[model samples]
Target: MQMEPIAIYLFVSALFILVILKIKTTNSSSKLPPGLWKLPIIGNLHQLAAGGPLIHKVLRDIAKKHGPLVHLQLGHVSTILVSSPEIAKQVMKTHDIVFASRSQPLSAKIISYDSANIGFAPYGDYWRQMRKICVLDLLSTKRVQSFRSLREEEFSGLATLLASHAGSPVNLTQMLHATMLGFTSRAAFGKKYQNQEKFISILCELLKVGTGFNIADFYPSIKWLQDITGLRTKLEKLHLEVDSLLDEIIDDHIADDNNNTSMHEDLVDVLLRVQNDRNYEITRNNIKAVILDMFAAGTDTSATTIDWTMAEMLKNPSALKKAQEEVRRVFSEKGYVDESNFDELKYLRAVIKETLRLHPPAPLLLPRLSRERCVIDGYEIPQKTQVLVNAWTIGRDSRYWEDAECFIAERFLDSSIDFNGNNFEYIPFGAGRRMCPGMSFGLANVELPLALFLYHFDWKLPNGMKHEDLDMSEVYFGVTVRRELNMHVIPIVSKPV
Candidate 1:
């Protein structure tokens, strides 16, 4: 029994190896989807890591070499990556219910109140109830339109600020981020809090950590790895900071309601009003979680879309000129850009669509979990498998798009393809029951800001940089992807508001 420490360690390692081998042997009989050769213990993790930080791009490459539906064993997690629209339809449409639930990663559980929020909640009664509340009360077409005045005010403020900096190099990225934050804060909490900037900064950090690529998420059985990596501690601290802010927000809303001093019912007011209802009984944490969902899901995504659209247009000046011309022409009679005239700016809409096609904010969308083992495309997907639908790859597939790699806004002008998830190849917002429910709200935020920027300013690269020299590289941050570098440009007042 008096063994050396090295002997003990070696014995444990041998046992772990045996267990891994046995598991692999057991699954060998099943008809799993095609996958790259994997090693024991770590599985396909090394391949993914080598491919780079952009998991979608790596997955795309793997799919090209392997098959459309690729099975990857990431540590103890069994994952299925769907690259083509055909397979994506099978997983998201044909067997939607079986894979409707979300894969609860460690960071998501921590930041989203143990997956209580609509965006990450498990598929069940609670998720259904939260989604119903969100669609009906918070994100309905009528509710989004009701916030039109707030959107206009925030964007108009941006136009004014940019106008002041006209002819000077302006950090359009920072301005757009601020504008989105102000709009989201007002829409969600009735007024922008003094700590809104802090909130956004912390949120950005959380997004980076919660990308579902954490070591702990891969090896769930090895719980100590979370602490070893300092991920658990970091997530807890972030959760505390975010939770405290949410608590303060809720307390302010409650105080306002009690005094009857609130002018109108914001999202917080609506959540509080239904807190005690028999049919939709929700706790305070639920309310905080939902409101955080609004900020997390609504803000960065719209901002990223607007950012990418501008970047893409700048990259292709011809598209930029066409979009600008349409924006100015359609809004000329109205004297200012508004959502009402957005319909007439067909080229502008096309530009946005093309941007989305090329660079989806959440390229992989949210990962879905399988509730039951099902056969997809003649291959068996085991129960509890995590599914990643590669929207970025599908959008760029030449089979679906003529010039998939190029930013051609005119391609969408006469095409019937849309991003409503019905068209699987163009599912920028995802598909099925788990599809993004805040589409209207998000689009409102994106369209108005983009139109305003186009209408109020003519942009040029700083230092007389050629448009071709613009860096269009993207940086992936958790669920959303955005420009790698902050866009810097000079704004010349085009049509002074």
Candidate 2:
């Protein structure tokens, strides 16, 4: 019954030819970039539906025809898709502040404690305070370095398990994902909590709905439909459930009188200490939101990156042989691979970099919203417009790369290109003020397990499947690119030299 007015409005809007004409005339003079013809109210939403809901592939195809910078109207959301490195520089570097604030989606609002977390928080004082704490206390070099021993212990445990299953087909994806969770759980919430699996399952469910593109996000005017569509109700339940769980964890920490005197502090301890301090005004919700960000994002993305890296290497045999050889030769000589000497494994680093280039964990690298109307390269961008820099497309663009589609780790060996935000050509972790602060921690999650996986055993495709036959296809539903099929492989023990 409540949707009747919206239904009538939609019916009436479809026949408002005069309104469409007026918009066309205004847009003609305003110099909007080229995009597909839009329909009344729907505004290319139907077109995107017809083409397929995979916005990454849809936008990439549109950019191929309309040029690197293309305009789109996803419902009423004014969107600009940037597919080239040059335009990426303009958005990420030149006019970063103009596009710094995120357009908070409805799902984000429900799940992130109303965008209280750093990743989705609108650019402002609260975001600044939270980010500073994360950088200085949680994600600082000293903090990340402090977690080195913890990572080594987790990696060793995983490697031992894999070795026992040598000469058998194992679900590398499942194993790696579980181990990464344990690793992240320890770093963020002290030891692997008794409810790590429950927390992980709940978090994953929340992310699936939160990160997905909801109808409400496209047509926010009908935001009440978020409940109509059932997304909000589902998220609200999960939010309460997750909140209860986090509260228990924080309560346990509060009960620990010795936490203050302990030499090592987990992220939760640090946040609690700050909360108790008079210098910063924070609540328990803020602490939980921050830790949620640490868990969901810090674990999932690195695991996705590792999975894609393994898939890509499997598809390209020479790269796999080279990566495994480099890991084994470098680490075997030292009798073990640890953080202090891990830096010496240059090729492994390059493989990780190359993997980031081809398959960035967040392909669109987080959507940024235009704070005010601005012009970029003569195209007028209206305030509140969504700006998505296609990091995946940019990474594979031939203009900046030679043999761009092929997996070649050597390109990054002795090369200047890096994942840091400065170099526009490659921004797997993104750039500017909103660039991911957890890069160090995320990299540690990916790099250590990846090196161990290579060093501990030789991996092969199941059932005599040739490397060329392995599927490198991806799952690009929203922003992240995960493997479409599970990467099942048999692990063989590596012979000692």
Candidate 3:
């Protein structure tokens, strides 16, 4: 019996090797883009791993050496790295529909309710319907506007908490995350749900696991590898935990009669109200998936953006002073900051633009899958090839910006460039059909809290450290990136003008 088992294993191993050889033979004929020479079986994974955990930075370095449009055989997967705006435009704009679908990683598939969510759903009618519902019902301009008071209330609590710890070192990272959590909870769940903290913890774990480089994702043909590596088991557990929590929330919403008639209908209420549409029927799992997408995308991205903006300003005091002066000059008379006069805060907006240019929440915007073989910049890209647009590299490209590496807010002062995806050179939110629909909603979350933080307090680095000494090292988590270390700063309440 033991000999029989060994014989079976040997046969399987031989089969796998033959399959890999066949794939290599087939790809050898294709005119793929230029890339570093890769080894058999492992492909360029060793090269990528050698460049460290910061995959975006590693890919940026590789692109600089090889070219902007580089191809790599990552295990069994064919991958494309786009570091230049022109190629990014070609892939995301000129040939957008051809590359509109997302690459479904194993983690995303398991955690996102089998890729049912808007973020990872396959490009089809289901995805289109879900996105439409999200835009029209949840993220519409009017709907986001309705949450203005909720934002103010959450920020007020944050400001009060900051005031209580004025002279002491405060973890701005944690505080900002908490504020966003509270705001998002009320907006999505109709109230500060009791399980909000638990949900946040689960989501954080999901992001960590989902974003981390998974070996199984690269080698999909090795089905048993996931089980051997225990990644599948971990993801299954996470999915169960998240599913249970979401089920409880949805059940509560279904049980609450008042939710149906409430003036301030939250996102859950909207989803529930629309679940039975004959033309676009949505299941309970689908509802949970969309809700998960909202929480995952809505909270972390906004909070991280605010966090990075603060760190960048603290490091560049001149830019910091200019931004503070502008905020105070505009809002000092009103004694509070709100969205009403946000249009006048030009320099502050510029500061935010600069921050995003340097530190996009998703350094490598969500990977796109080519629907069919297409020619990009004269290079033939294969069907189902995974595409990663290095927004971090494109943002800092010297061809676009003058002092590309510096934190200069003035560069955007008179410039017409914006991050709405029209200007391919600076796509913090991505572009094309797969572009984030919650741009306005996310910016609303970021701009208000950031403006309030500046208006109410003068910040100092903890332990008497100089601004230049502050650590701005970043850690990538899931679809977003944030400072590796929580920002510890002392807040000095500004005197009433």
lDDT of 1 by residue, 340-433 (tens): 8778888888998999999999998888999998999988898999999999999999998887899998899998988788899999999999
Alpha-carbon deviation at 367 in model 2, angstroms: 1.0
Which segments of candidate 1 are over 4 A away from where they belong? 1-30, 258-263
**Per-model TM-score on C-alpha atoms:** 0.92, 0.92, 0.92
- The list of candidate 3 runs beyond 4 A from truth reads 1-30, 259-263, 495-497
- Model 1 scores a TM of 0.92
lDDT of 2: 0.83
**Per-residue C-alpha lDDT of model 3 across residues 1-497, encoded as one tens digit per residue:** 76999999999999999999999887764578898888999899999999988888999999999899999889998999999999999988999999999988888788888899998999999999998987888788888888888888888888889998988999999999888888888888887667878887887787778768789888888899888988899889988988898898899989985845434788899888888566678999999988888888898899999999999999999888888888899987888888899999999899989999999999998889999999998889989999999999999999998889999989899999987899999999999999999999999998987888888889999777999898989887776889999989999999431
lDDT (tens digit, per residue) of candidate 2 on 1-497: 99999999988887687789889999764697778888888788887777775566777888898898888888878898898888888888899999999988987788888888889999888988998988888899888888889999998898888788787888888888788888888887787678778988998888887777688888888768787888888999988888888988898888875745333888889999988888788888888888888877887788888988888888878888888888888877676767776787788899899999888888887889999888888898888989988888888889888999888899989898876788888988889989999999899888888887777777888899998898877776345778888789987777421
Question: Residue 280 in model 1: shift from native, Å?
Answer: 0.4
Candidate number that wins on lDDT, 2 or 3: 3
Error of 2 at 36 (Å): 1.5
lDDT of 2 at 122: 95
